[model samples]
Target: MNIKIYQRGGFKDNHDVLINATEYFCKMLMSTRMCNTLNIRLEMRSTKLGKNGLGSCYTDALGSKKNKDFIVIVKRDAPITDQLKTLAHECVHIHQKATNLLQYRLWKSDGKFHARWNGEELGVYDAIPYQDRPWEIEAYFLEDIMHKAYFFNNKNRPDLEEKIINGFNNALNYLESERSNNYRNIVSRQSNSLEMAI
Candidate 1:
């Protein structure tokens, strides 16, 4: 996936970690072909969200049957662990949208948001409580598991922790040289090593 992260308000110190985590989530949830076709933008913001909201995922159709473009807005002021968990949660929603497992449509006549899950209409969106939403249920269930898998449960990659530490060091260098117009591209190249490590 082509993932771009914009640090808008605060918590700008962990770009590399965020990038690696996003790539990991994409790899875990989607096939390689799907991953290659996706264009994901992650916006980190310090603004407050409703209630306990930590992040949200907005999927766009991009004028095609396949919805390949997505924007994920995450609360930046939260702890890094919380940020990663929220990111994992949003990534699951992206996967759901991409695979057509979850979808929403607005009815002009009734002005109500309708949801469909696995091709079955689920009635008005607001009718379903937050915890009862199937999509949210899946996302919430997998968030911490994905986070733990990326960090602690990667027994197959014994060197993962070392690589992440090294990636953070490289991130500092990248931040220092971020004035370059090709900074994103540069970080993309640097992230390749971490991806391999993952």
Candidate 2:
């Protein structure tokens, strides 16, 4: 999948700021050595307006693939360095998809699609398990390594730090429990189906 990162801005300052964020994220990804394993293509662009966002992976032809060509677009208003965290978070999903980690992540919950991710299943575009699994553990670890001590401490973005810790911890726990329950049910269903088929 080709993932494009777009930002909004035409000035030199915008480039400098955005560059700061991009370098940090790429370095993190490179250091993690994830790029060598994941085949997804990534691109970055800047925009002048719109909420900083990441994503792209519409289903493939015939609705089998939820989103094939992925794109992560972000606005220039956000502190580029901080926004990179969001990219890191999403990039983990891309990694999961590239490696088929998703096959084990999907679970049916209340007739709806769900994953261990902080976001909804809709984010993954699949009722398929593991499609949109949570990356909270990875996100938190990366945030601490990349932001909490350096950016957050030096910039005094305590509020951001509080939100990251609270949100990541709470979301990860909920997602884990939900995923476990859903997986159990899915296994039971699969077993029953196999028995019936035989």
**TM-scores of all predicted structures:** 0.73, 0.38
lDDT of 2: 0.43
What lDDT would each prediction earn against the true structure? Answer: 0.75, 0.43
**In model 2, what is the error at residue 146, expressed in angstroms?**
5.2
Instruction: Residues 1-198, candidate 1: write the lDDT tens digits.
Output: 798999765557898888888988887778899989999898887674666778999875332255788999888788989999999899889888888878887778797878887667778988988755767756765676677667753455647745654554454355335423324554455467669999
Off by over 4 Å in 1: 61-64, 153-198
Query: Which 10 consecutive residues of model 1 have the lowest summed lDDT?
Result: 174-183
Predicted candidate 2 versus true structure: per-residue lDDT over 1-198, tens digit per residue: 123334334433544443444344444334445443333333344532234344333222222232334344443344655455555555544544433334223334444333423323333335433322334334433443444423553466878756665664564455457564544543455568779999
Candidate 1: C-alpha lDDT: 0.75
Clashing pairs in 1: none
